[model samples]
Target: MTDPAKHAVLYRMVMPEHVCPWGLKARHLLRSKGFTVDDHWLETREANDAFKAEHGVKTTPQVFIDGVRVGGYEDLRRHLGLKAPDPQAKTYGPVLAVFAVTALMALAVSHAAFGSALTFRALEWFIGLSMMALAMLKLQNLETFSTMFLNYDLLAKRWIPYGKVYPFAELGAGALMVAGVLTWLSAPVALFIGGVGAISVFKAVYLDKRELKCACVGGSGNVPLGFLSLTENLMMIAMAVWMGVMALQHG
Candidate 1:
């Protein structure tokens, strides 16, 4: 008798116009798990449909191990005791990455300029750099970001042009703040936009209880609107206030 554990069969779609990604993943996963895959391709839509009907399965990329049907890519993962990704789970990876990189950048700049990494300037740079990074994400596709921003931003909804201007304003303010220059200009711009954004995020997520995607990372991300979104705006607000006070004390 042959050992069935070492052998697996996979049926996946391979049409001329497109190929199923899950099918490729299933094959790779099976190979990585030390199983020899007997790959079978359903090259046509008709064949795919017929195979699905015959197997009584709605989706393709079906895997069979040792004559036992193990189902599709997700099912194969479960059978192999692997953790599959959950589509509904919210992730803060983008924001976390931005914060982490900006924090490092702040320390580097502080050490270079002030001969110290843990100075007051480092905190300001961290916030400023983070703001710039976030603005860059939105600026990647201004139209898309503006469209999504309108969904929950109060000022953007009231004045449509504000959505279009937001990325530029954020980028400009962040750049100026990081340079520690033009405090008179950057402080007010940061204050106004941050104040408005904080209120809008608060109303949308808390008061109205609406489930919305954050436009912070980009228009095309799945990051849910919640605490991080509010925190971003709040940081800008706090930075603006602190900068304004410093400018006043110096003047």
Candidate 2:
């Protein structure tokens, strides 16, 4: 009889958030072992039917080796003899762990360049950690570098959301960074946030001489207008660039 394992296949189904974190290891190992791995991926709900029919299963990350139904992601790892890393292990534990380290790096870069090392100022020091926020801040600050973008009338009229625009951009980047940590799109989110933050910061420095009022975010009077403000924005820009570089390295 022919060996069924000779023509084995590997299958992976990725959905909103149920993808196997270690699936890459199994696939790579199989390829390295001179196995004719018939690997297939189903990324949509519509593709589930065909996979379910073939595997007699209706769940994601279904694993089959030599046409024998093993199980989901875990079974696939087992079939391929891929050992699972400890959940509590610190090194190479999760993909998010890498991003988390990048986030820390961005914050560290910002702090090393500016701001006091106070705990209350920690958030401020780490503000540029996310790529999206950094880029946005840079772009927004490029012109006038402050609530200076908004006229006094608009500030008084409570149209501050559109007045400064940098904060809104920062807010969006921050949200993306926070969300990225919890989702598979962490790299993309970080890239975008870092880009925005960097843009705002770079702009602030580039347009250092422009005079602008500090309506603050939501009239909060947080981000001031001046060379210091420009310095602040650049700090964020550097952070974004760092994050983008990190993502590219990981990818």
Q: In terms of TM-score, which candidate is strongest? A: 1
Candidate 2 lDDT tens digits, 35-94: 666778777767867877865776655545566766765565666677754443322222
Q: Tell me the whole-model lDDT of each prediction, alpha carbons only.
A: 0.94, 0.48
Q: CA lDDT of 79 in candidate 1?
A: 95
What stretches of model 2 exceed 4 Å from their correct place?
1-125, 128-148, 151-166, 178-211, 220-224
TM-score of 2: 0.29
Clashes of 1: 0
RMSD in Å for all candidates: 3.5, 17.9
lDDT of 2: 0.48
Candidate 1 residue lDDT tens string, 35-63: 88899999999999999999999999999
Candidate 1, superposed: residue stretches over 4 Å from native: 1-4, 11-24, 39-60
Q: Per-residue error at 56 for model 1, in Å?
A: 6.8
